[model samples]
Target chain A: MRKINSRQAGKKVPDYLENNIVRFVYLLRSEGVRIGNSEVIDALQALQYVSLENREKVKTALKATLVKKAADAVIFERCFSFFFTPPETRERLRELRQQKIARHEHQIKEAEQVFTFRGEKMNLSALDKTVYAYMPETEKKRLRDFLEMNESRETLQQWYRPFLETLVKGRLRFWHKQLHKEIQEVIAQRDTGDEELNAIRDAAAGSGYGGRTILTEDMQHITRKELPQAAALIRRMARLLATRISRRYRYSKKRRLPDLRATLRASVQFGGVPFKLKYKSCRIKKPRLLLLCDVSGSMIRYSSFVLQFIYSLNAVVQRIESFVFAENLERVTPYFQQGQDFERTMTAVVRESGQWGGGTSLHSALKALMMRYGDELTGNTTVIIVSDTRTIHHREAALELEKLREKVKEIIWLNTLPRQEWSSYTTVAAFQRSAAMFPCNTLADLEQVLSRKFLSA
Target chain B: MFVSLEKLQKGFTSAGYICDEEVILTVYLALRLEKPLLIEGPPGVGKTEMGKALARIFHTELIRLQCYEGLDENKALYEWNYQKQLLQIQAGRVEGRYGRVDGDLFSREYLLERPLLKAIQADRKVVLLVDEVDKSDSEFEAFLFEVLSDFQVSIPELGTIRARHIPIVVLTSNSERELSDGLKRRCVFLYLDFPGIEREIEIIKARVPQAGERLTAEIARAVHHIRQNQEIRKKPSIAETLDWARTLVSLNMDRLQGSTIERTLNILLKSRGDQRVFREQIGADALEKKIRSSLV
Candidate 1:
């Protein structure tokens, strides 16, 4: 083992040889030192000793060898202790539990867990559903046993006593989680179900109880997936529109459009000479951007960015309608909220829609959107179809696209397919009957696609 | 860090930033409150520079923690030096320094210090800048709050080390990723935006004092154009603007006209992303639109 005197008085041997500074360093890490990779490697190299039994020694070697930078040495020292630190879990829990008890110790009113037995249908409130989810199987069985032991409500009440204490603890934890959830939600439903727990000795209450919530809403709150931040791609487009500068017209208002007041003001400046005055209006458009995206497997990555682009466009795309179509078309408007957890929400979307990872039946999916939303498309519609058109087409599908081309003013097809990947003539000639095709690989291209001036009026 | 921030800003007097005393003061108040000040802005608006400047000004010390994917407390704070301790025992026999040996060698004294520790144990109030924290994994964010709540670090060996005085903590993110609520609650949030052309021109003069007035105005106008063009991947960051200004100063150019712009495009834009976007917009066509818009 390498050795060196840590104190300044002695010659400092290399760490690989036996050294107090080195051993202490490694011990700090194993016993919980913040050891960096370089330190460990250096210490091991110095000692030239290889074995798992000397884990602490290795850490010490690293501390002596690696920690040369002062700030780093301090950080390493703090980290060693932190990693090795026990965190006073007991004391923190005691304080937390006391606080929880003081806040939530009790005033129970009415909370009933509604069950949907076979063939019975009843609307479950958010509270009822949450209670059901939070109830453990053991407690549920106890409740069931209690119910089975007696037919009358009074007898049931008698049986629920012993288990009441444990349930109270969990219940306090539950609502504390809810308080942490959405302050608005907690404020929304505050006094509807609670009063002092007189009938039962120890029931759930307010402030003190805190824990990880077991309910879906609580889970959603923690994961940030409870709300949607956008309505459609239009909002995103709007955001883009807000931060963009348009091709400004030379004139404030076009002479043809006739800005009477501006002209009069200019004439007044000219002392009523009333010479020719030009005017212009801002060229920014508020077009209804109808974004139709393909959410099939081949288009997953591109689809996400397309969604983000649509989301970012805030005011640019007016009344955006987004439909993710694989084999079926699903509108995911409610899942785009600011701070929404996409992982949780998207998982739910894929599960609920059940069509995301399936197939590409774009033509039929368009048909579904058309039938349901025929009124939304005007004569001046700009249909932005974002896809590479990957299909196991029942060739009859292309006819519907042709039909769609005939209806709207313009159809812009954004191909996610790379430039080199184009082997099919369908893009160059097939859909050319009425649609404009552009190769889009990145957000920049998508921006260009959406920015084309089709209709402003 | 605010005091440090002041020093750093003074150092870069020629970059043309009119340091809003109000914004700086607000940040100073937040730091005093031990709140994490979050600065958000489009890329290149000088979000990261603020942190670097604060580190320099503090004199107490600057501890920088660059955040990225899979970052954990171990990387940010510390880990054990296993090899060193083993060797210490082996060498203990030779010099008879064995009596002085203790496990506390692996303690705080021998422990390596990271940014977080430097800030906590500063002789003077330090500045702890958790840069691009949003880029790190979200799970680790919960742990961030635990430290923020106390301004302390718990070391099993040393028991605990808390801030003797809370250091100024600033977090800068590009909003490329959303931060967790746990973290958002612990800090004061601010979003930095692009300053207007007039403000930017003034900034150029202030930050780059030697820059010619005409050159500064032209560069600022060009920067304004780049910001307007969303097609570019790398928007001209304040840093790039400084570089362009410096280049112009060195070249002895008084004004920015067409050819001068082409020569310096590489300085303003680092990659193909910026180059392509710049090419698409910064020419006669773009200028025509700019002029036309102005005329009416």
Candidate 2:
């Protein structure tokens, strides 16, 4: 155990320790852990009481003072271990970073030598060349064609040489889109050669954190080991959502008219002066939910997560009707009502439905649902459709959804496809026109959409 | 208050609360810094017990405020005894002494102190346990901000009631809902998970000394095995484990036999669904075999 001198009463914190704590706090904030000034001051003050001889005591003190949520605890542990390394280890890590930077510079130099335009040397900066090298073949070909088409001998002579470079760089920037800055950052970090430092930076930045947290990880990519943790998170989120919905009814109770009979009954103790007035107990109308999950091959992973989420809400939502669709719609509410293990329920649902992993037919499915369960889709019902919006006869499906929207309170489409790729699928745009569509490819996305949309509604 | 972490641990042990160094460290720091300790975990993880243990260690009163839906300031903090006030008003009018009625109505005599106010006005330090705070409404949670941070509560009639002695406050949550960032900021957070098998065996031996060593070890192992079943909705809590051990001891059982577990499983698993799953999925015979294997 490494020991440091404890701060005495009415004494200031050592400058080095104070700086480390501030840096650690900054790292935590960057990693999405919210820490306030009061917490920092408490941590410093707490350090005075605990013996510095015990490392665990110091760590526990800081963690208790700083970290509030259980979810942020993982990030705190990682950042703590990284921040509080021994001096010799930190020095070695610093040297390793310098060595990596040297290797990155060498690679950049080599790339610059081979980066030529039209058999003549192109005088582009190392950053520009690195970005150009990272582009795909198709984008590279497009860039070459654009240069060939735009750069005429006369124009090149009339304009400055730097103008052509600027023109090429602008096209490269446009091709990279939102990722242009991130790519530039990666290249910049390469020059620093600080792998551990970069890891900490990336972890703190919440982008490409080491083995991305299960919440932010793609639903389809969650491994067998992480499945239990993912399920727990989903259950926790469902309970939270249920609580929010329940709170609405609690608030609505206050708005109810006074109960005259109960007020009079209670006034017997006070000689009928009516000191304690009670509100009329309102019957809570639990929100009716209709879940339509697409269990086609393309959307099975996302559908499983959605089904699990809905199943977890069974205790809270009394009037939920679940349905699964592939080539046709099949009501699977019975499977959920059985209240068995979710995995077994899912297995039974897949076995009995006969539509699992088949092609999607949203138009036919919606029509079938309307024909069979038309009475169930009242104005109080909110229909949530989980799909990638990849279906046969997209326009007809969109029309059917619009019709369903008229009969229901709302239609929410949770599209499994990433939002960036939505433009590529005409079906997504078609369904989006009729319903409020949100990306549901990850737990974070699902959480954001559900909390924002459902809570507001 | 304890001067060192070791003494705090020993105090907790003597108080019959089995905990690790981390828990002791957190409690020590919270006591030293005079901050409210926010303990969150799954149900039956000894969160509320921590408060009770603290009270025992300090020889202070354990003032508990059980939070729930629609809980408000009138229930948690001070409230004017309206019936008494009305009677005073009526009597004053009858006696032609109305001038003194208004002043006396809102006085300390008419102020009914709830748990929050009671803790604040206590002559000596006490352990104020705000249990299941997540079950309370957001407005009530926000109202707790003033009491927890500055140890003071403001009444419209009475200006402000600062704590006579800063009570050691322990707030426990099952995480049914996410607490506000503002409430979390003013607290020292500690998460208490279920103890491991060895520690749990220690707990069983400590709490239920009537049970033999083999029986305690077998019960701990059996509970641990049952907890590993993800399909079991409600895992056996430590309290439930102790109850099961006590039940077995009362029944004059030395070991967890398959038949005994089937008969006494109700004590461990509360929900019918969980019991059914435990029987159908994690069979008693299988758990018995696993427990017996440890002996070999």
Candidate 3:
């Protein structure tokens, strides 16, 4: 084994080794591993005890000190291997590192030019510097005077009233959009060769431009061929939703109530009078879920996604009954009840129903569904209708939905159509009168509904 | 504390624990950085045993806090000595110094230290093992942020108690429940799966020295073969492999026959379902096949 005392009393290690450690930590931080300032110092000290000759030990020394999660450890291992190449490959890495530093210095200069606010002359706080980037020239002057004026500064220092007045009336959203657009323009002007900046741009593409959640934008339109990736995402969402719902139910169960009979029984041991309290605990039953999906020709893509999403949740939810409808209603719950493979079961259900590529007529389907399963709906059941109400040449069926809503605990409508398209559809406004409606035109919308409505409800 | 990774590997071998390069490096970094190493893996992978071995290797006190459902800060951290506080109050009243007893009940004299508090208050370094931390509630996991990052405990009355010597914290999890991201951010993650055939043989030799070389090798090979069947619910870990070797040596069996396998099968397989699956998958002929290939 090669032995070297890099920490020999007041002597430092070679400059190359020190730079290697710092660069490794920098690469880790950029890859989203949370490495604090103290963690860096601890890693440097840890290197003194590890053998640099053996690559495994040296890499482990960095990982065990730097990474905090098992997921992050995978990223750390990949980066450490790339950074700590053989001596022959070191020159290429050094050249890349130098190029990266030069690019970073250029980005820093651009940021300094962009963020150099005139509010510094008025002795404004650092918050004014950030707000100045989004403000027009006229507003910048107004804000400057507001900061310099004694009375306005006193009001701003109050923190509560000033904050409410400043952010109220949707001003925060306007400023946020302005700042996002300004920053995007600045970033787009830079060299696209930067991999790190490209990663950020790719991430921003999914969240929409200017960080705006446009209701008219159908962000994720599922297709038949893309079912595998959607299925995986649904399975992960199922696990999280299941844990959250069960944890909440378990928490309520643990808070026991004082039972009179139990307290009286325990009092007999203490001379007919109770000094200590005894409680009775009961388990809260999980709410049953009933899904009615519209599988018409207009809603084929959305129906498949909603069905897959609900079936994947069968692992967490004990009681789930699913039905698909176009002109007629057919219960597909038995397929899921068989515990078969997900894709096979879904394919079997789709073929057996034979409702694929059908015309829209929710009126007849709802009437048939109620006539067949009237006794199944109860106050313990949550009825969810995943559909787009294009009614076509059928009745509105608003009164039937109202009657069905009274039988169930709650009726949640996950409208696959965009919010802007709802007003154009004749039957959607009437249907919304009976059920609590939420937009489900995108994957982000579906995730939000699952977390907020299903888990919390 | 180790000269090299190989030296650490040898040190663990002498300590009767055969570890690979990853484990040795993780433990050495844990010692050098003084950060908590959170070990996660499947059940029966010797995750908890690593904590015990590290404590032994460093010759530090091992403070184990076994976590379960509804584990709270008061249970894992510190609690007040109610009876001692009452006694002190009575003494203060009898001595006519009732006014002086204010805030005295919350002092160190009336504090009963739990595993966390004891670890921080320890004069020397310690190996604090929070075993099966995933079994605990999310709130308790959140409460560990202070003790983990700053090595201190905060009480409203007693103020903060900092560590005199930073303990070597090792948290073990079987991944029964997902831990919070906040707690995961303050720890170094290490995952240990079941040992391979060669590592299993080394572990068997070190843990069960009384067993013959041929018998140990045969047991390791058979176990390696058995673990290949994914249908088996609980694969035999290193501890189970050692137990199997020791059982064979004590019974004076040189070969692994059907009767010997039948007699000591329970030592390796815990569940009846897993045993049934193993027996159905690997029958008499399969056992003979494993034994034949084990020699060469």
lDDT of each: 0.55, 0.79, 0.69
- Model 1 DockQ (Cα-based): 0.02
lDDT string, candidate 1, A1-457, tens digits: 2222122213332433334433444444432234454344444453443232464544443443444322234445443332222225323433454454454323111123223222232243444334434455575566546433443444445345445434444553454444433332333333311111110101111221221222112111222131222122223334434322221112234335655545543453333334756464645343445667777887775545555544444224335666678887777655544323334555666678777667788767878877887765766466777777676663456677777777776787878764434543354355545578776764334444545444321
Q: Which candidate, 2 or 3, has the higher TM-score? A: 2
User: Which pairs of residues have clashing backbones in candidate 3?
Assistant: none
DockQ of each: 0.02, 0.48, 0.18
Q: Candidate 2 regions off by >4 Å? A: A1-15, A98-199, A202-216, A223-229, A250-284, A340-344, A361-381, A392-412, A418-438, A444-457, B1-3
Model 2, span B73-184: residue lDDT tens: 9789977776677677778778998676666666898888999999999999999999999999888999997679999988877798899999999999998878888999
lDDT of model 3, residue B131: 97
Which candidate model has the greater TM-score, 1 or 2?
Answer: 2
Give the top-scoring candidate (TM-score).
Answer: 2
TM for every model, in the order presented, reads 0.42, 0.82, 0.60
* Chain A accuracy as TM-score for every candidate: 0.38, 0.68, 0.50
RMSD of 2: 6.5
Question: In candidate 3, what are the lDDT values of residues B170-277, reduced to their tens digit?
Answer: 899876455766676567678888888788878877777788788777888888888876556578877788788888888998767777887789999998866877
Q: After superposition, how far is residue B184 of candidate 3 from its true place, in Å?
A: 2.5
Q: Write the residue-wise lDDT of candidate 2 on A53-144 in tens digits.
A: 76777789889999998878888887777667665654455455557557657656755654444446567765566666667768777776
Alpha carbon lDDT at A58, candidate 2? 78
- Quick one: ranking by lDDT, best first? 2, 3, 1
Stretches > 4 Å off in candidate 1:
A1-457, B1-17, B56-58, B93-102, B284-296
